[model samples]
Target: MDCEILENTVLLAIVTLISVVQNIFFAFKVENESKIANSKSSQKTSSPAFDKVYTANQNCTDAYPTFLALLWCAGIFCSQGPAAFAGIMYLCVRQKYFVGYLGENTQITPGYIFGKRVVLFLFLMSMAGILNYYIGVFFGSDVKMYIKAVSNTVSPFLLIP
Candidate 1:
């Protein structure tokens, strides 16, 4: 396999590993918190930890497919460097969001803002990549070559736009 392909594969695997670890951590937390919450005298209604963990797990599960799709599209069609960067950022933001959700004042977590922005960035990256790929295909141009040509003249900040 090509070195770039191998590198991107490894990067994707690492991202998957990160997600797995986070899931495991949240699962364990939920299990432990649920038991404690159930045992408490006044906890019959709800447990903050249990609720937070459950919601975080659900959110992660919902976002997993979107993350994978965006990662692959951007990595394959646009460039590995940007895609990997965005993927890693997405993972970090997700982790932070999960952690922040466990706080007492969950409604005011900064992670919510950061995570949403990261998702938006990933979405934009995927869209740009898909557009680039189709434009290259329709015009009988090498996609990578076209991307490179544009990258050479465009500012880094403007690439996503």
Candidate 2:
């Protein structure tokens, strides 16, 4: 199979790993906080640690669908390499955001900012790629030719398996 055919699967696996890490981190932190609070349940706790972990987890949960949509759309319509790079960066920043939020809320700023920018970039790329495809379909422009040329130029350097 061509590597291009597997781009979405690779991206999905990366996203799933990031999500699993976040969930595990949240579970461990909340469990530890529960122990310190002398409670068996951390849910709805007033402890600062629980609050931070819950907030971080909730933020990621809220943003996850949108991120996945943009990532997949961009990867499908645009080239895989840039989409994969941005997806990895977004995942890394999410990890940073989780860790930073645990320390100081203000420390999350860098990750938050970068993550937002990456999402925006993915959105733009998706729009451009989709528009290009439709234009080719509607106007008989050789979109595949253009995409093939660009891919041929870039794919050799990407070296995806």
lDDT of each: 0.68, 0.73
RMSD of 1: 4.2
Question: Which 10-residue window in model 2 sums to the lowest lDDT?
Answer: 152-161
Off by over 4 Å in 1: 1-4, 41-46, 106-109, 142-161
lDDT of 1 at 145: 60
Per-residue lDDT over 1-161 for candidate 1, one digit per residue giving the tens place of the 0 to 100 score: 79967875776667667777877887887888888888885647766667878887787778888888777776666666656666777777777777777765564366566656656655665677778777777986556666645533442442241
Q: After superposition, how far is residue 35 of candidate 1 from its true place, in Å?
A: 2.3
Off by over 4 Å in 2: 1-4, 7-21, 31-45, 143-161
What are the clashing pairs of model 2?
none
Residue pairs that clash (backbone atoms under 3 angstroms), model 1: none
Best by lDDT: 2
Q: Residue 57 lDDT in model 2?
A: 78
Error of 2 at 131 (Å): 0.5
Residue 61 miss distance in model 2 (angstroms)? 0.9
